[model samples]
Target: MSNISVSENEASSSEPENKNSPAVIEESPELQRASSSTVPPDVPSDEPPDAPDGGWPAWSQVVSAHIANMISWGYGTGFSVFQLYYKQTMNLPAVQVSWIGSVQIFLCFLVGVASGRLSDGGHSRQLYATGAIICIFGMFMTSLTNTYWQILLAQGFCQGIGAGLVFMPASASVAVYFKKNRSFAIAASGCGSSSGAILYPAIVQFLMPSVGFPWAVRICGFISIALAIVGFCLLKPRELHRVPAPYLDLKAFKSLPYSLFTAGSFLVYFSLFTILIYINSFAREILGLGDVKSVEFVLVTNAIAIVARPIFGFLADKFLGPVETFGLNCIALGVMAFGWIGVHERIAMYVYSAFVGFVNGGAQGLFTSAISSFVPDVRKMGTWIGMTLGLCGFATLAGPPTMGAIVDANGGKYLWAQVWAGSTIIIGGTMVLISSRLVLRDSAKPSAI
Candidate 1:
């Protein structure tokens, strides 16, 4: 007993040195002292360093991520204002105008593959700075555009490409700063994006009358540039020594949960974006509302999002887990979309829009956390998140136009379009449900292969 006591004392005395020592590579990824044991081969370990989850350093990263999201996706969602303006003034068919937003979203997703992979390789800051400059340049150019083609090239291609570059890195920056409260952290980070979505419409709706279109757009650009500079000055990657990873690691899909989640994400984005794009048209045509009323509808929806996203994340972290929460949210959103078919009166439509925004907004931000939950290796999270987003970008590209075409073919009735959106979202939810169950099973295992 004395020998055992002395040995324990000696080991305890050496514990500080063990904490200070460099992480040793184990032959097996099976048994780990890190948070989870599902890490794959080729990575050194699941955790290189413990995340400083609550310090100013960690929360500051969350703030930086919020700024990044505000500049990219928050501004992107504001494209509803542009869509409304173009539809009213362009005289082009809705289908043709829809292509502009589609291309913009498509490029945003498409660039994720390269940008996300590079972010994993320790290039996050550089990529974000470059992307910010490009986006600012694109916005300024958009302010100068008079022709449709010019808008497409400047706003759609350039802005979209720039957003794609910054978004995944922004999401990944927060992932490295927290573990236990990861879902809430990522969800809280989305607050800026939702706020941006709300603020932008007000910016456009108020500015266009007082400052005119060109200056209003330029002001929006200025806001984006200012916020981006703040983010660039402060944002940091916690794991400074993250090893570079492959842009397209097909091996990741071998896990059925990951693959199933990807498919679910594709369908979710595909169906989700359609409602956002058409809300203005739905208000003006179906409800006998005017331009201002339509803009208000968009504003109300996004405003609800500002509050909903973090709540979703909190629930995910506290009770449901990210995957299960995401699946449930998807199902809820599907039900809400179908409910849209029943709303026709002005008051009812307003309420419906708010609820829809609440559900969709939370769902949008939830996926970032959900996808992160599946990636055991935090170092490669950017790669995995970017790849999934890149693939889902195709759905975003096709969804708005596909729904628009359906509306056009159906004599401008939204019944079929709503039906399609609701069904697609429900199907996506089921896929996520399957993924959540699969992941729960894998986590129950004593050892991961």
Candidate 2:
């Protein structure tokens, strides 16, 4: 919240931004053992650090970050609806329309590596502001695009990159502030993403009818501008120490358990967007549901996830180590994937959506903590977070269209798509189980809490 103007010279001169420079991710004695070497993988016995005195300010930071991240989520989700509008109004092919969404998802995660490094090196506000500007530009560009590539470049690539920039710092800043309730804070941030899925689709559906596509997109653009300002004002680093930016750490690959964890995360993340974006269309075409009902189903699923995410986080903090928690959730997620087997009627659809939302939502809560636990060097957190998410981003990039391709391959049916998604999720759970055990066994037990 401080009006700190970080100069480019200040950032660059401070430290050479590279991973092999030196060790920066400092941890408590117990944390070092739990993550670095052989240690007990149990929750620490001591209480967390006390809450800051200015309760309102602390709460504001969380609220503002949530609003900013949610807006980013809305930007991406809204773009999907925009693509649907283009297909309907401009007569774009399904395959071509698919590229717009693919590019957006890929660009969002790909650009995050740079954004994460910037945040780590004490230029969060500047980097975040720049990202927001790009987000706004992407929206404005969407209003102008008529061809598929234009939309892909503008709405997909540009918007995705911009939103990606906003997302990492906003979420990471929240992590820097609260240590004890990190899971809850992250869950709240995740809720913002879910809210975007709920509201943006409706916004597009409602506005496209009344204002038409161009103006409707403009409305979304203005919304991004407002969100950027609020986020820019609230963003700050928790501590003032200068840390080197984390380039991708190849040493992480030396740890086979870490590699498996990353791989499993990739599989789960890849199936997520594909399911979220295409489910409504599947409900309408495959199950013969109405448009309103189809949209409501998506909203309901996301709404349930909002609560599930936080609750899962709370449980992880209290009862299990991050890796164990992640593994458990993945198992539950795999079980819930079976719920989608025969969702024919309206009642069945709602039930399936609710269960899947809870399971998948909880899985994310576990995933974030798991990554943090595996990489306990808080100093280099931004880099590790970026690297892990960037890997997940690769999954997200492939997820949507792979499912779309499956749908196309199945003569436009989601039956095979659902099967493929469920299989991937189950495989993710299997990997989580094996990897968590390996991590727990290898970690060194430290003396201090």
Candidate 3:
């Protein structure tokens, strides 16, 4: 006991000298002591290094940031040009040719769930680069293919993979970057698709006659390379303390409002792409318009949609809630689908295009906003969105071929397909409308009551 007490006293006395001694210093002991210490770091006061603040990206920054996405969407419009190729060049039956576009659209969105997860994991840039490279390769490969199967593999699968990589990340990034004006930001992101829908077809038409399909496709491939470059340079994610989100969270879909909204999204996209894929062909053959006029009709709708998306998004945020706006737009789209039943002349086609573009644009912007509302927990949104989009991807895959089959069964007249599409729009619109009403009712109820 006397020896133990004397040893303790000697150890305590040596502790101060050991801490002060530099010659016999060891890192682990000092680290252990530092961990137990309550005092903070004794460093000079200065502004800490941090990521650049993104306070509502400037107009030029906004456009520059979004341009690459727009070009990607524009690249998708190349499928519309395929309508002309199938009908005029390949001389394939409408039903058979429709599969190419349907498969492409299906694959693009189908892969979005996986891509969304990748983005959440801090690998978006690599995923995007890989997609662009694959898509460019597919485009060049498409120019060389003659058979339907070859084109499907190269254009549909490979190109579709590229598109899938770009879509969700590009869209979700808008939500991440802009909170104050989220609707407008989403609308801006959407411009890429709209521009792609319009410009690609028009450009292809101008070049296909003179340069031939192969060279035209190659030109588009080169353009995609440029697009990918810009995207890598400018499309940066803002650094934030992100809680890792599940890539596929099914439980979030249990919310009734979100379920209904997702159902409506599936219906809308199914019908939307069906019309987009078939409209140019319908305008040319069924409506008896010239090829140039038919393409112009398609172009006009996409161009108008660019403006309408931003305008309606603003209205949804400012006046109506996202649910209300989605319902209204769905209703308008139904009306436009019905109007298509009577469209034959160029003038009527133009009117129909403008109406459909306006309504569809609004619906798209509203749906993105509404989905986020239901899954208010930020960390869970990516996973919830992935599941919903997966469902939507399945629908997009089936819609075009199914519509084309209807046209074929009806002796190459699109009237049957048109009626089916119109009915679908009405049903989807009603679902969204009922859901919106329920949301409004809930919001209006007084807490005291």
Best by lDDT: 1
Evaluation by TM-score, superior candidate among 1 and 3: 1
- lDDT by residue for model 1 over 119-177, one digit each (tens)? 88888899889888888888899889998999999888998899888877777888878
Candidate 2, superposed: residue stretches over 4 Å from native: 1-58, 77-80, 90-93, 444-449
**CA shift of 305, model 1, Å:** 1.0
Candidate 3: the clashing residue pairs are: 70-192, 74-196
Q: How accurate is candidate 2 locally (lDDT)?
A: 0.67
lDDT of 3 by residue, 347-440 (tens): 8888888887777777765566556545444444445566777888788788888887898888988787988887887787777766655543
Q: Quote the lDDT for 313 in model 2.
A: 72
TM-score of each: 0.89, 0.84, 0.83
How far is 234's C-alpha from truth in model 2 (Å)?
1.4
Candidates 2 and 3 compared by lDDT, better number: 2
Score each candidate by Cα lDDT: 0.78, 0.67, 0.66
Q: Write the per-residue lDDT of candidate 2 for residues 121-190, one digit (tens) a residue.
A: 7777777787789888988898888877788889888888888888777766766665555666776767
